[model samples]
Target: MSTPESCIVAGQLAELGHTSLYDLLEQACREYADKPAFSCGADSVSFTALRSHADCFARYLRHEAGLQPGDRLAIQLPNLLQYVVAIFGALKAGLVIVNTNPQYTAPETRHQFADSGARAVVVLDKLVPLVRSIQPQTQIERLIVTSLDDWRQPQEQGDAADETRFMAALAIGRTLPEIETGRGLDDLAVLQYTGGTTGVSKGAMLTHRNLLSNVLQAVSIIKPGEVEYGNEVRVSPLPLYHIFAFTANCLASVFTGFNSVLITNPRDLDGMIADMQRHSITLFTGINSLFVSLMAHPQFDSIDFSRLKWVNSGGAPLNLSVAQRWFERTGSVVREGFGMTETSPVVVASTGNTPYKEGFIGQAVIDTEMKIVDDQGQELPAGEPGELLIRGPQVMQGYWQRPEATAETFTEDGWLKTGDIGVIDEDGFLKLVDRKKDMILVSGFNVYPNDVEDAVMRHRGIRECVAVGVPDERKGEAIKLFVSLHDQNLTEADIIAHCREQLTGYKVPSYIEIRDDLPKSTVGKLLRRVLRDEARAQVQP
Candidate 1:
């Protein structure tokens, strides 16, 4: 499946003539000049205005801020109209955007700023206090602060000691002359940090070519005639800082001309529903947990999904029950996909044409290649579960400043070693088994947490659950299950009894903790490492 010529064809799918995201943005502005590029709350920007604003900001970076090509600029904001402007503006200045999560704590924020050597940060006003404290500790020299309401009304320029307000920067930027960056494809564009699920967070270095290719790859999955460019509204609830949303929603919108409705706070289900009601949403992207949370909302049935054409699930495993409930209620199948931050996020996805099947992640997109390999690095036969390795243009150059890690992650042949175990069928469809690191050993038996969790999710009373391996005396390691429930009446014994019917004795949880909540990442992916750490700490030495 992975031939040199096929790879060339895949890269060509993006029409490299556009070269970089900056080129694509320029083309989008020209082609869809008057179209709504992005909307958040009451503010919306047309492609023409977006280009003008971006140009102004780019000028500010070059002349006022003295930022040059390849300089790292951190953007710490929610899904606001300003976020879109800052992205294009930074790109125009040839700045590498370090997408920092707005909710990041002081330590997390400091580490990213320090690690990436960010010279400037565009942060939300509320989060400025944290950034203020961490600024002196890092190389950050400029602070461009913005508020949620800043887009609605331009704030008067502030003479703050160490910062420039966002509106003020744009106002100042508008007067500066545009600087030709001469930056394009193959140049690093973003430093997307991994979730640090395994250990410390590291930035995945993504170039323009990597992201652009993934954008084309994602758009290609729609197939021709499925979408009407410039006539679609995408309801994007995922955080833009996440690579999944960065490529699939933000970057893809540039190429497809779809107006993206940025959901600033997806947790506010009522507000999200209101946004959905306001826009005739044609595309929706979310993780499995978000889908479940939305379905459980009190006014879920009140929202109109009649215009919804496609619903995509990624970032985590899609539970069969959640997917089924979504289809039954919304009449849209929840097509699942698999991606990693290192791959500019989208490696494989289930398209609209794919049949609805449990655990099916569909096939690799136009230019990507995937193979299953055993512990010895030998390729596994079709239908055999093993570690999944990927090779594609979308794959990142490497982790930033972590040469040892980057070296360890790639094979001598150039395939990226994805720690997740998966099986590919003869027909090319893929099914994820579990993370290789998350695999549990129970008295000489190999137990995958996904299998155990999938079985437990089958019970009608369960809302969400995660399985982790804990140190066991007799068994090498035992499964520990943590769950949040729909029916509070269901006890730990009931879950165990139910799992017993579906899984073998060793696969059943040795202990069940019925909690009101479970630890989750910002994206709503359950943090098995957090639970595992807690479980191990409780065990006696």
Candidate 2:
């Protein structure tokens, strides 16, 4: 395998000189103007065109919307050209970009908007109703809406009425005033939310320096000339809101000036496979669930995997069965890595030629310091499973507006306590054993039990509720709820119905277990571990 020195280029790429992501993309545009920057189905945008469009959008945000630097602009749309335009435009205009899941319900969307204090929102048409429903309760003053077919259509075939409305919203931007631009490398770039063990979703304050450092750190891992500017092709099926894909796939592609094939709807397996067959993707990054699902697809066997030079798996543990199957089918190993949203998401990744380990999460990236520590915050010996503490430039400054939580997450010496139980082998391979946090990962997305329990407790007929993760064949783990009802006549169906009203699809419990009482400690704290154990035992033969 090539060492880190072998991957180091003599000089930085032209894009590397920019302080902000926007400047970086603009630099690429000047250097590789004719190269394709983005593609979706048959529609494509060149680096030069993308830069011009981004400039127009940025000008629209500055002149029309009255937005300024450091202001938060919430983005709620699937992966597409607009997603890129909006993201780069906001960054270029000196705005803090707050990513929102397009699939979020009204309540979920409201929480993010309110929490982030976003003043503007760019939403897809299908999600406009959800945004409009919660607009009154949010701080959003400007709303811009776009449809899936907005950029892909011929001008005559497009919805002129809807386009006029969107342009009017952009025109309203002129009446609003702009703030002075003073955004710095240390200023917040993205407010990426992460579900903590306490079940509270806090925004990780990733600064421009934090993200830039991660991008550089990742670039150091790739061999020079292996993937060049504008020539590399990346397949990004993961949601752009996810920090893993946001940095590795989206921003990385921008840095390298690659043609990023944006998959707007990854759930359409047949359609996604068809796209893969059409494009000769060079770098493919995904989670275990995604790989497993793709392997299960009937058309998956027919796709050409020989062209794929790099495959990375993260977000969740990669299963041995899936890895073996993938390697046998494609002769390419899925390089497993590990990171958290708080870390600007890239910590460790296995190299292109490294041997595949069944459960190891590779070694720390260049210049990253990682150590395993015991519960008391003392460093542990190698091979001992404990909490992982990381110190790196990519680590976020802290949780936004959360001083106490932030203080608790970091050590006195400045190491970030990752809240993940893992062990480092003598050779430096980190193997994750379990999560110290009670957070359940459903299909690689965090599902906090406390959040669900809180929603369930809000039900009038519910006395108490406990949420636990149960093993699932599809999703890595599914939430199983145990409830104690105030009324004896209250049924499981009724309880579930109430939960569905307040929670997102993944947060809603899949299985409802009725219990007279739950196991609690002497201090009255719920014994969630006991419940999880019981749930696992029940599923076993």
Best candidate according to lDDT: 1
Question: Over the stretch 1-541, how does candidate 1's per-residue lDDT look in tens digits?
Answer: 1113346534464455775687777888778988999998767898889889988888888888889999999999989988988999999899999999786667668889999999999989888888988888999998888988998877756546668888888888988876886687779999998643343668999988788888878887886787899889999998898788888889898788999999999879889999988888899988766787788888889888888888887766666777788999999877888888888888888877555455677898877899999999999999999999998888888899988888888998889998889999998888977676666655433466776777788898999998888765445467899999999999999999998876656578989998999989999999988998898898741
Backbone clash tally (model 2): 4
Model 1 accuracy (lDDT, Cα)? 0.83
Q: What overall lDDT goes with each candidate model?
A: 0.83, 0.79
Query: Lowest-scoring 10 consecutive residues by lDDT in candidate 1?
Result: 1-10
Candidate 2: tens digits of C-alpha lDDT, residues 1-541? 0012112221242335556766668777787788888888778888887766666667677776677788899988889888887887788788999999888778778888999999988887777667778989989877777778877541222132323234344334445544333577678999998887777789999988778778877766776666666787888898888898889878878878888888988889887888888888888877777887898998898988877777877777677777778889888777787888998889998875344455687878876889999988889999999999898778888998999999998887778998889999888889988889888888778888888888898887888888988877566678899887788899888888888888877788889999999889999988889989999888731
